[model samples]
Target chain A: MSTSRLARGRAGTSWPRSELPEFSPRELVDEINAGVEQGLRVVAYFGAAEGSDIRLFLVLADDAQSEIAIGTARVEGKAFPSIAEACPQVQLFEREIVEQWELEAIGHPWSKPVRRGRSLLGAAPSASGSSPHLPAVTDFYRVEGAEVHEVGVGPVHASVIEPGHFRFQCHGETVFHLEIALGYQHRGIERALATGPDRRSLHYAETAAGDTTIGHATAYCEVVEALAGARVPARGAVLRGIMLELERLANHVGDLGALAGDVGFLPTASYCGRIRGDYLNLTAELCGSRFGRGFIRPGGCGFDVEATLREQLVERLERAFVDTRSAVELLWGSSSVMERFEATGVVPKQIAKDLGLKGPAARASGLTRDARHDHPSGIYRFHQIPVSSADTGDVFARAYVRWLEIQRSVAFLRDQLATLPDGAVRSTVGPLPEDALAVTLVEGWRGEICHVALTDPQGHFARYKIVDPSFHNWSAVAWTLRGGQISDFPLCNKSFNLSYCGHDL
Target chain B: MLDLFLARLHQKHRTLAFPGGPPPVLPERYRGLPVINEGRCEEGCTACAEACPTEAVLLSPRLGIDLGRCLFCSDCVEACPTDALSFGGDFRQAARNRDDLVVDEERAIRLATALDKKSRRLFGRSLKLRQVSAGGCNGCESDVNVLSTLVWDIGRFGINIVASPRHADGLIITGPVTENMRLALEKTYAAVAPPKIVIAVGACAISGGPFVGHPEAHDGAGSVVPVDLYVPGCPPHPLTILDGLLRLLGRIEEEPGKRAR
Candidate 1:
């Protein structure tokens, strides 16, 4: 039995690598499973290869206590007992570890490569037949029956969206299972980030999931700032919060519009498409880029808001929110939209809990999980956005929860921007402390975005693991499609709007 | 239904008057083409080149920049000690050839030329393109998708993004062309009928933008297929994308003195 207590940590903070509790592979599995049974959720579980062995790291979040427990287990061989069977949250993480390292998760059910075949640490094992391992080429769960058939959608979809493949096991119009195969968009971001926080690292974080650029970049910056022990100015912290909420407003509005489009409701659909750009334009108005690139950095914000620009931003934000309110108000007025939305895609609260879904998705399922509320950091500590939730766990609930958040975020931005803090926006960040591990969690529009960085002795990145919200909720998306109408796939998908690149990365 | 009509009316006709009217006024902070003041540079200073994440800045024979690889980030402009390079709002950043993507102090970007007369006749009035995001971060994909919204209303120009490659007259490719998506992109390109063209949108599709030099990525679309036009920007603005499409279709002429600021 491992008696050493796990190294306690707070989100968006750094701890020395030497301080982590060490456990055997079996002890690690048992400890994590016991924690999961006691209501802790797994935030990140990854491996960093050391010679022939692997150093497995785990980050478990206790939302009730606002604490994170990090521990490492040394796996001497290629095989370790799977924790996925007991704690379903690490199911994908275990599979990824197995693929990235050559370590096998013994007794893990349905182990498969998460991304296109290649080991993150070194060269992949050569296959028996000719040709190397192909991405999205794997055994899919099959339903055998006379009437059961399969329909496959592309790595190149009809719409102008990121590439991913989807296989639906169908019995005529009813879907038995939906397995999403991604990694067509893998750009080797994690591998590139290892060994340095070079100039290109921020760009990688900014584009990790381009739509969640602010969310991911803030997480990246927070982790770096934590590692270097840098404190951002009050003004910069407020600006980051404003940008994050604006991002939320943009995506939530866009999703509302997209949901309308999927339901064939044209008014809200058309209005939202432009309104989404309007919110994005506000970010563009602050920073040069519409996506908020080059805005957030390690020390603080790259740009600042003057009194004049602040007034202009306030005016534009007011107008955009008004338009957004009018446009979104129509979605609820129409019975046709409501009927289509109310019961379309339902994920039970228990299932959502078991899956460890985050952000609005979990909130829609009656789970009161929000990083801002649970693990408050930076400006979020000073200002609080009340967690908005819905109990239905359907398309309507998801959409409604977004609407609630939209209103809340608009209010928050209005209040925060008016009481702008006067201070220098940026500070010089010192060199990172040698041999540190930092974890950051952000409440992105889709869900929780977790970024874990482990530095070597020289303070360069040894392993940079990014766990996008889509990684957790993609399974929920699949669950939503179970016994669902195949035609409703597009509608259900719009309801969640999970990112393929975020998951694939 | 009345409420829907009222909401529609409230949303109003928000489309931009571009190419027909004055070019839309972009915000001041918008970073378009980089203007290099060659005189301001120190004798052997390579600050701009060193600051660029994608090696877009070339300091050899004076300062030249590769727009195809530029993310339009503030890094270079901020890093310049002599104030040599500043981003000017000149949104016409599409080029007909890959070589034209690299611009120096003296010359502006060679805006994309129209398709040859025959191909122009084929796709001028009705160019249906199928967009494939090979390894896009969704920035390019989302911006391209914005073109079809009421604000841009790209279909008003008789262009649309069709649902199938078979029905498309061309392919608008975005991304760094990851190895996994290369085969699928090729198959989609082949599915299009003859006389089809390929347009690479954003820096990623043109020159791998931020993901440059990654082993999994093929750098750009040109490696897998020929690119007829290169639209520059990390994710080129909707106007930038629209400008490229119209330029290639010969719908809009390249006005010498007109620049959007």
Candidate 2:
């Protein structure tokens, strides 16, 4: 597998000079198959092109090794073979493609139209028929059983979360099958980008999935940098890595607390909430915004740490680490919390792999596919940050993986602080290149965030596609929720915590 | 069982005591309240006025700021590279009347100076705060989340972000004040029960961010109400936000000179 040749090309820094490897739809598919044959797993595939013809980009990865590739193809004349038949992970992306670009995926078992009645692509549906841009009725799945009813749970939930619908097929208290309906929150972010200025487009990209701002922005910048042939300075790279890890730590803390709360572990939840809030306050102290916004820009960061402030930050983090460790230990020792988390919503290893799961979801299943290590960007390449994984893809494993990651992030932050560099914080990024096509990927707290940027003739953004990790993982969530008791749904859902707005966009 | 007790004992109550002592101020560099630098004014340069997307700045014969209309986007500050405009740490800008919010250039400068002095005096101090999303895009909320994580570690400074407004000494509001969230915003303020400060984080909260002037937009947090400190940016940097919060707490001594420089 190490020597296997899929498609070899040198990774370039910028766009106009970057070689554009134009391949026919069939050739692209063949290349994808070649990569898959060589042990590369297809993580996600999304459609992004103007007019009738839809372009598909496949994100391929390997868990045991660090090799990532983005391959492109055009689905011609309406009929595209379903990868879901071979890789169950493609099902959601295929459904999303059908919903967004109105592409038809043939021979997919569960190829249901997930997001119906919402398409802002064009005008209202004509009197003649439903909009061709919208998914057809045939695209929806039909479940049959006596006295088995389907309960639709959203477009909106009671929580502070974004909108998404959960279709549960329940027989008594047991959930036999689950289907998710999303896209209600689709703000046409990608389409909106195509019409906006390329330089200022990163703002919208940062907000594509609000929580994953840094991740999305990092990915967007990476794509731009690659297409533009710009090199992010070493200091900037380190700062970016620090910011990414900070983002990861903050999210993990918040999610962990929320997960504990989902299981009625109020104390743990409250502690975690308080800890999470403190973490955010620290971010504000360090960078200025609670979310680390504006900290990251195109080529580098917008601000740098002062010597005294950096030392203060380091000491503060150390104190926080000690406190969090003790709190976690207490939570673990609690029988009530352990009982609720363990063995609930278990995702088997085979199922996890077949679904092409990534991030904590895949890591819990023993697939230690971390973007920080796998496709190392910034200072991550230099640092030996450990990847947390477990074979048991259960709620406990998810929580444990997050806990472990938080510790690792703490260590990473310490290393960054110890070797704080004194240099310019930001570097100038030149104008974007015209007729540029590039892909950038970053590992968000949830999973890999991929962005594909296409510049127009006037060097403005022609099309920008963001493939959030939630887009791929939501299906896995539904699959995991199946066969579990209905009461455990919230715990299972909380374990994954897929972003509705992230996926919908 | 023993571990739980020990952990609880070892865990210093991270919540800051506010209203009990002088409010914990902010750091010198913290970005918080807005102050106009009268010295940098080009004797009638309307750059800030022109760049004010929301027309928050009224630089007629007398320079005055309608705090009700001022989003605190800091565009006026950024547009003023001469450093005439700055963020004041004194984020207690709440009032009943629109007229109360209106501050002449001299008062604006003075308020800005007072905040600067107070923040510097209370550096590394703690404050109890409440966060409200007054029709925000959730971006600011996410950033706020990052502020508490291990990397930033805002808790070490004794800052506690409470959930309930009544328990808070200050309010961190992020949003463009969507029509639907208007009541919630007001209720949050009312619930805080006064002697409370308000920190507007993000362009949306400060100046409706990008949603300003949109027919779809519902005036903005500032338009519907008043703000104490305003940290500007589409979403201001987490550090800038921290500075605003710190200033409100009176942890750090503030410098009005920075605003004008």
Candidate 3:
């Protein structure tokens, strides 16, 4: 892995292909073994490319993390050994690939269909109507018992959060296994991006996930910038960073409040909600809209922050920080709240890493991976904010990690404001390169947001694939649910808080 | 137990006296009701009609605003650019009849100027607000949250958002009034014992916003209801929102305040 040729070239180049070692299907496991021995952690396995009808899987190794083009492209027509036998992490991706791309993973036991009837690419049943739809990966978890009935919760919940169905097979209060079925809220955001829209394409991107407008927009801009070979100005980068941090802080505060409310801590919930509201108001003050909408454009921020307004925001944030700290401390001191969160829904560090969880979720599990720190983009490099990490991967640890993140974000904001430079806020980002393939990875509040953009010859988007942090972390949710009591579901769910719409999109 | 008692004392009584005294009014930029620029329309310019996304602005060749379809998006004012199309400062646009809702250009301009003069007479004020979500996408509701946040700090300006309409001096409504939420909106309004102001926050609440005339939808806050103030925009900027709120409190002066540094 250390000697791997992980070079990224501009638009069109085949030179790097010659530098890398090539392997057939039978040698795939051997190659993976070599990489693992050399300290490569496989991040994800993206299914085959559509229309190519070729069996291909993308392997994102640890060493290649810094490299923009990290994933290995494996063609299925060639002989390749299934890594599922060795790496259990590859099992989930392999299952998805089986249903989506219809590629068989040899030696993989849990290769059942995941989406069943909703799968567009899976093989359909014959006219005999013996089987109405193809079986999915969810069917494998069917429990057999006298009174072990399955309780299905949501494609739509009572809350404002997006849709996700959780099939809890429980005997009384204790849960046996929890199976999650998502994709109800998919609005074809990626597909929409593939087909170009005029100027309003970013508007569609903004709505990919309602709560994550800033994160999605920042990632989207990064992809377009990489593709167009455009460099955002220093000031613009700082502004973008501020906006991103603000979004992260607000969401974290709100989640903490909601988690507290779920555990019946009303005072903490109200206080946190009020504090979160304050942050949102600050966002509205800086930008014209709350939720930080329309703040990030292609080349820069939509508006510049005036000095007077910046000072006002700083004062407001100072008050908010004090209030938030008090509220959090109060909640932490409450024995009831602590009892509910302490050891509930623990995700071991090893399991977290193998699953490639990012953001606060991974950080809480002692994985020192932060896109802001590791893959420094925008003003992150300049600010030098310490990446918050904790060893306990429980609900309390996750909440604590977020609290620490809020402090860091406030400090980062002050630092950025102190060194705020004067320059043009925007530059004209011309059309994207035709043959270029660019990938952008950003540390959103939830986790990592990765966007891969490919353009047509006419400078229009040919394919744009957005992998939100939720996509990688949702599998961890099911794992977190295992062995946990039914009462702890909401707490566990809040600990991860993966976006349903984001994953669906 | 001692700490709990102390904590209870530390909690500020989150209640403000309103209506009995002067109501809390927001700042100048708060988006509230559609203030017709009778002066601008008096010149026979139909810029608002042309600029409206949902044709919420109805300016016939002779008459000015058909308040029935008018969404207070401020597009008319933005289109004027001449500073003639000014907000009327009166947010009570609700009416019992469609005819009463109609604003002739000349009458609207006169009313706006008169309201502006009256607001100038009172310098210090406050307003009690009750917010209702008719059929909003929740975007406007989020913005309303910002009003009380550290940045805008609408509370500092004496504007307090009350939980119940009975304790309110004005109604700050957001949404296009979806069919499901119609009853909720009406009930909320009915709960507010009158002399209460109704401030429609977004284009949706005013003229159904983007949801106006949506073939796939039925029911609008305006269709089943009446509005006093119409602040316009998809989600109007918080400043504009503040301005509309202030007008309801009679806090806004005849002229804009000196721009703060």
Measured by lDDT, the strongest candidate is 1
Q: Give one digit per residue, the lDDT tens place, for model 1 in B1-261.
A: 787777767888988888777777787899988898989988888888888999999887769899999999969889999888999988889999998988888877888988888998888888999999988999999999999999999998889999999999989999998877888898999999988899999999998888878778889999988889899998898888888888888877788334322
Model 2 CA lDDT for position A203: 60
lDDT of 2 by residue, A59-99 (tens): 56654456555556667777677756765666776777776
| After superposition, candidate 1 runs with Cα above 4 Å error | A1-4, A124-132, B256-261
Interface root-mean-square deviation (Å) of every model = 2.2, 7.6, 9.1
* TM-score, prediction 1: 0.98
Greater DockQ among 2 and 3 belongs to 2
**How many clashes in candidate 3?**
41
**Tens digit per residue, CA lDDT, model 3, A396-503:** 989989989999999998888777889977787877765455666678898777776656556676556667777778878887778778888988998887876576
After TM-score superposition, the amount by which residue B179's alpha carbon in candidate 2 deviates from its true location, in angstroms, is 14
Q: Give the TM-score of chain A, superposed on the true chain A, for all candidates in the order listed.
A: 0.97, 0.90, 0.88
RMSD of each: 2.1, 8.2, 9.6
lDDT of 3 by residue, B1-261 (tens): 464445445544443232223334432333334544455444656665666545655655443555544434345666765555544544344332335545655444211111233433332255677776554544566567656644456777677787666777666776665433444456667877765666776656666544455321233455655665666555665655665565445554334442111
Give the per-residue lDDT of model 2 (tens digit) for B133-191.
Answer: 65455676665655564434568667767756666776777766544345445666787
Best TM-score goes to which candidate?
A: 1
Q: Estimate TM-scores for all models.
A: 0.98, 0.77, 0.70
Instruction: Answer with 2 or 3, whichever has the higher lDDT.
Output: 2
